[model samples]
Target: MPQTLDAAAVRTWCSLALEALGREREEIDAINVYPVADGDTGTNLYLTVESAAQAVEAVFAAHETGSSVPAPADVVRAMAHGALIGARGNSGTILAQLLRGMAERLGDGDHLAGALHRAATLAREAVAHPVEGTILSVAGAAAQAADAFPQDAVRAAYEGARQALDATPGQLAVLERAGVVDAGGRGLLMVLGALVEAVTGEAPVAPVLAHVRHEIGDPGLEPCAAGGPAFEVIYLLEADDAAVARLRTRLDGLGDSLVVVGGDGLWNVHVHVDDAGAAVEAGVEAGRPYRIRITHFDTTAPPREREQVQRAVVVVVPGEGLAGLCAEAGATTVLARPGEPPASGELVDAIRRAHAREVVLLPNSAELRHTAAAAAEQARTEGVRVALIPTRAAVQGIAALAVHEPDRRFDEDVVAMTAAAGATRYAELAVAERQSWTSAGVCQAGDVLGLIDGDVAVIGADLADTAEAVLDRMLAAGGELVTLVLGEDVPDGDAVADRLERYVRDGYLAVDTLVYRGGRGSTPLLVGVE
Candidate 1:
C-alpha cells in the first residue's frame, strides 16, 4: 500500500535516508574521483541528512507538548533549513539546495512530480557551472520520470535515478576513465530509494556500481588525479539576497566547483580555491560569516598503508581555551558548543582522525555517556581498541589527562586515568535564568547559582561572594589542590582568581591553587577540588 506524502512520510524518509547513507558511506567515499576527490562525499551526505533528521525530531519533540502534530509544511521546511546550515562539501551543498527546492513546492501543496521538478531546477541553479552526468542530471531524470508516472511517482523516480546512476560513466569522461559512476549521483540514488521505501513500504533493489571492487592499481580503474585546488573553503553566512548575488560573482572568479545554497538571509557557501584565505576574505566582505572550515586536500596519506600511533586521547571540551589546553596535552579535543553537542558520528570521526591503535575517550559530560559508548563500540568494530573513561565534567577529564601515560601498558594507563578522574570533585558557578526552587533555597532571576557536584548548593547576589561560598563548602571536606577555570565573560576574572588564590593560601596551610581561562561559552567559573 502506498502512503500519502505527509509529515509522517517525510520523517520516515529522513530516517531511511540517513540509515542508507550510513551503510553506504565508505563505499561511496571509495569511488569519489571528481571535483578534487577529497573522498568524503558519503560522509558529507550522511551528516547533512543527520542534521535534517535531528531538526525533524526537534519539531516532533516541540509538538509533543500539545495534542496536535506538526503539519507537512513545517516538517519539510525544517528538513530543508537544517540541511542548508549543516551542509558539507560541494555534493552536500547541492543536496541541501535540492531539499530546499522540494520544501518550497511541497509546503505549497504541490504534488510529488512538481516538487521533484522544482528540486532538480533549484539544485542545478545552485551550482556555478552545472555539468552533465552529475547529481544534477540524475535529479532531472528522476523529476522527468516522476512527471511521466504520477500515480507511482516515488517508485518511478527511484528507478529513473538508478538508470541515471548507471549511465553516469558514459556521460562523464572522468567517471568513465576511473571506471566508476558519479559518487554524488550514487548517493542521491540511495536517497531516492529511501523515499521509495518511505512512500510504498517496499525497499528498492540496490544498484551495483561498475568496478566498485577494483583495487587502486587495477586495470581500467584510474585513481583520482592530483593537482587541483589547494584548499576547500566553507562557511555559513548571514546576508541579504543582494549581498549573496555579489558574493556569487566574487567567488566565481576565485575558484571552481562553487556552490552557494540557502535563502531567507542565511546561506551556506562552499568553493574550492587555491587561495583559501582570499575565499574566506570574500565571505567576510559580503556578510557576517561563521563556522568557517578550510580543508587542505593533501593532508592524509593513501588509505592503504597509513601508520597508526600506539595510543591517543580524545576529550570533549567546552571552550577554546580548554580545547587548546587539551591539545597541548597531546589529546585530540572536540569542542562542545553551548547548545549543540557532538553526535556519535563526530566522535567516531575524531577517533579515526586520532589514527591510533588504542584510544582513550573522555566525554566530559554525564549526558554524553550513551553517545560515547556508541562511538567506542563503533571504533572497536573498526579494529581500534577504545577505552571510555566516564569523566562527568571537563575538570574530571583534565585530571584523567594529567595522569595519562601513553608509554605505559594500555590497561594500566586506563586504570590510572579512571582513578584520577574518579577522585576529583567538580562544581560550577552559573547565573539563574528564571526564579526557581533549588536544593539550597528558592532563587529568583538574576541570582548567582553555585552548583556542587551537579546540584545547586548556594545562591547569592554577587559573583565573588557566591564563588567564595561554594569554594568554602567544597573545601570543608579537606582538599590538597584547588583548580579554578574562569569564563571569558566574567568581569575581572584575573582579580577574582587572585582574590580566591589569596583566600585559599591564607586560609589553608599547604593547599595549592591553579587557575585557567576557559575562554568563550564557558560557565562563569568551574572549580575542581582534589
Candidate 2:
C-alpha cells in the first residue's frame, strides 16, 4: 500500500474537499427544498472547512519545521476542533460532526484505510434523519469505495468521491428537483481531491481566501472554542455594477453562501474558504469580507453558568438600531445578530463575552426566547448576569433599553423596561415565502403575511389591508401606543402615517403615532401609535 498518511496527507484531503465544494457550491445551495431561502449549504460547510484550514495554518506557523511528517493524529484533532467552533448553519453543524468523526477515526489508528472507514461510519451517524441522495449517503459510498478499491492511493479516492457525488441526484428528491447532486457531498469530494493532489506531490499554485489551499499544520486539538478575534477582517469593495456582479459570481467559485447585502456604495462580502489569505486576496482583486463586522458565529459563545466576574450586562439585538438602544440602556455589550435571531451557540457566546456580570439578555423576538433562555441556563454556572427578558420584538427590546442604567442599582428599571417591552405591541409587513394558511386568511406564496405579536393577523395582496388588521389587533388589546418601524423594502414614512390615519384615525386608537423609516440604522419601524 502507499505510504501511511501523515499530517500533510490530512491537510491535502481537506483542501481537495473544499476545492470540490467551491466548484459546485452555488448549485448545492440552490437545490435545497425545505427552506428555499436558506440557499447557504455550500457556504456553511465551506466556512467550517475554512476555519479548520485557518487552524491548520496556525498550527504549522507555530512549528515551522522541515519536511518532516507531522503526526496524523495531532493534525486531525486540530482540524476537528476548528470545524466545531466555526460552524454556522445546520449544514455547518453536520460538517463539523463529519470532521469530528474523522478525528475519531484518526484517534483510533495511524493507518489510512481504518481512518476512512471511521469517517464513513461517523458521517452516517451525523445525520439525524439520513437521506439517500444527500452528502452523507455520497460520503458513505465514497468510504465504501475507499475500503474496497480504497487503496492508499489518493487518486483512487478522488475518483470514487466523484462517482458517488454524480449518483447523488438519482437518490435525493430535492437534488432531482433542482437538477443537481448534493452540495455538501461535492464539498467532501473537493477535500479528498485536494488531499490526493497534495500527497501525490502536486503543489498547489497558491492559497486563495475564497478557495481551499492545502496547508499541513495542526488545526487545533483543543475542545475549548472561544475567543473574539484580535483583528476584524473588513471588506471595502469599490466596483462598478458589472464588477460587483462579477465579484459575486467569483465568490461562488471561491466559496458559495456569501451574503452580498449592504449599501450601494459599500457591499458586504463574507465567505469561509480554506485559504483565508487567498480568499482575502481574491476579494481584494474583485471585492472583499473586509470592513469586517466580526461575525458572532465566528466568536465563542459566552460562557454559560455564570462566572464570579466583577460585573457585566449583555443585550441581544439584530440590527444597529437595536444595538444602540441597548447601549443607551446601559447594556455593557450588545449581542447583535446581523439581521436575524442569535443561534443557540451565538447566545452562549454573547454571554461569555459579557462575562456574566449581571448580564441582561433581551431576546427581541418571540420565537427566539426559548433559544435565548437555553443559552442563559448554560451560562448560569459561569457567573453571568444574563436576564432573559422575553422581549417579543425589536420595539420591546428598545423600550427595555430606555430604562437600562448600569450605575444605578438593579431596581424597578430592569423590571419596568422589560415590562414595557413585553407589554409593547408588535407587527410585520413582510411578503410570504410560501402558500401557507394562517388565522387571518389564506396566503399564497407571494402574498404578504402581516403579523402582530407572532400571530398572522392579516394576509392579503396589499399592504393597506395588512396594516389595518395589524393595527386593529394592537388597538383591541387595550393598548393605544404603537410604533411601526418599516423594513428595508417599505419606505416613504408618509405612506405608513397616511394609511394608519385613514384606517384608525376615527377609531379607538387614533393616528397619534411616530413613524420612522429609511436610515443607515437597522431597526423595525417603531410605529408608535399612542
Candidate 3:
C-alpha cells in the first residue's frame, strides 16, 4: 500500500536514501570516470544526503515539544536547504539543486509530477553545459515517467531512472569505453528507488553493477584518464543571484565541471580547475565564500601509494588507568584530569596523532559535546574523516569500545558503537564538596552521593551502603550486566568491589558484574548497567 506524500514520508525518504548510498558508496566510487574522478563520488553523495537527513531530524526535534507536527512543506524545504549548504563534488551539487527544485514545487502543492519536472529542469539548468548520459538525463527521464503515470508516479519514476542508468554507457563515450554506467546516474537511481520505498512499504530491487567491478580491475585503481584539472574547489557563498550569475561565468572560463546551485541569497559553488586559488578568488569577488574546500588531485600517483591510514579510534578518558585500558584496545587516548576536561584543540591533536584517514572520536563526557563537535569540524577541514560518539561516561565509552570493529564499514561501525553506548546506563559515586540540592534531595558536605545518568539519585553515609542502594535501584529497572570502576583514592576500594560483586551475584539471577580500578584522580566509583 502506497502512503501519501507527507512530512513523515519525506523524512523516511531521506533516511532510506542515506542508507542506500552508504551501502553502495564504495561500488559507485569504483565506477567513477566522469568530471575528473578522484574516487569519492559515493562518499560525497552519502555526506550530502546525511546532511539533508540531519536537517529533517532537526525539524522533528524542534517540534517535539510542540502540539503539532511540522508541516510537509517545512520538512521538504529543510531537506533542500540542508543539501544546498552541505553539497560536495560535482554530482552532489547537482543533487542539491534537484532537491531544491522539487522543494520549490512541492511547497506550493502535493503534485509529484510537477515537483519531478521542476527538479529535472533545475538540475539541468544548474550545470554549466547540460550533458546527456549523466544524472541530468536520469532526472529528465524520471520526470517524464512521473508525468505520464501520475497514479503510480514514484514507482514509474524509479523504473524510468533505472532504464536511463542502463542506457548511460551508450550515450557517453567515456562510460562505453570503461564498460560501466554513469556513476552519478546510478546514484540518482538509488535515490529514486529510496523514494519508491518511502511511498510504498517495499524496497525495489537495486540493479547489479557487476560489470563495474570487472571492468575497473582493482577498486583502488582510478578509472578516468589523467590530465584534467589539478584541483576540485567547492564553497558556500552568500551572494545575490546576479553575483552568482557572474561567478558561474567566471568559473566556467576558469575550468570544466562548473556547477553553481542555490538561490535566495545563498549558493553552493563547485568547479575543477588547475588554479584553485583563482577559482576561490572569483568567489571572493562575487560574494563572501565560507566553508571553502579545495582538494588537490594526485593524478600522477596510484591510489595504493597515497599515504592515508585506513581508520583509528580516539577516546577521551578520565583517568590514567582508563586511558591505558582504551589504548590497549587499539584506541588513541586523551586524558582528562580531575576537574579539568580536555579542550577541543587537545582532541584535534589526538586525532592528528592517530594519523588515520578516518577517526572515531569518543568524547566520553556530556560537557564536551560541543567541544568534540568543533574538533570534528576542524579535523574535517584538514581532510581527516571524524565521527563523534556521545558517550557521557567512561563506562559508556567502555561499552562502545567493546563492540568496535575497525574492519567494518565506517558508518556501520559507528552505528554499532553508538547503539552499544546508548544501551548502557551510567552512574557515578562522589563525595559532596559542600551543602547542595540535587535531584534526589539535599546533601551536606562530605556526604556520599550516588549520581545516576548525571543526576543525584542516592545519598548515604557509607560507601558500601550507597553502592548497594544504587545497584538495587539500577537493577530494579532490569539489567543483565553491571560494570564497576573503583577510584584509586577510595578507601577500601577493593573491598567495596568484592562486596558489590557478591551482592549482585546473590541478589540478582543471571546478572554478572565486572570491576576495574580507575587510577589516581578518578571519581570515587563509576557504574554501568546494561
Best by lDDT: 1
Angstrom error at residue 390, model 1: 2.3
Q: Write the residue-wise lDDT of candidate 1 on 190-227 in tens digits.
A: 89999998888889987765535375334454434466
Q: Kindly report which residue pairs in candidate 3 clash with one another.
A: none
Single out the weakest 10-residue window by summed lDDT for candidate 1. 216-225
lDDT agreement of model 3 with the native: 0.87
Q: Pick the candidate with the highest TM-score.
A: 1
Model 2, runs deviating above 4 Å: 1-292, 295-313, 328-340, 491-494, 497-512, 516-530
lDDT of 3 by residue, 392-411 (tens): 99999999999999999999
lDDT (0 to 1) per candidate: 0.88, 0.58, 0.87
lDDT of 3 at 101: 93
Model 1: residues with Cα > 4 Å off, grouped in runs: 1-4, 61-74, 107-110, 208-226, 299-306, 432-447
Scanning candidate 2 in windows of ten residues, the lowest lDDT window is 216-225
| Clashes per model (N, Cα, C within 3 A) | 0, 68, 0
Q: Tell me the spans in candidate 3 whose CA falls farther than 4 Å from its real position.
A: 1-4, 208-211, 215-224, 304-530
Write model 2 residue lDDT over 1-530, tens digit each, in one string: 45355677677666666666656555555544321223556766766676676556556655677755457777887787666645655456556666766677666564555666666676555333456766666567666666676555455555666777777767765555545556566666666666667667663332222212123121311212233222222244555556666666665565433434222344434453334565566667764433333322333432265545544556655555445545655564444433323455456666666663667777776767766787788677665655678877667766667666666666555676677776676776667778877988788987877776667777777666667777776787566656666654455556766777666656863445555442333532333332
Winner on lDDT (1 vs 2): 1
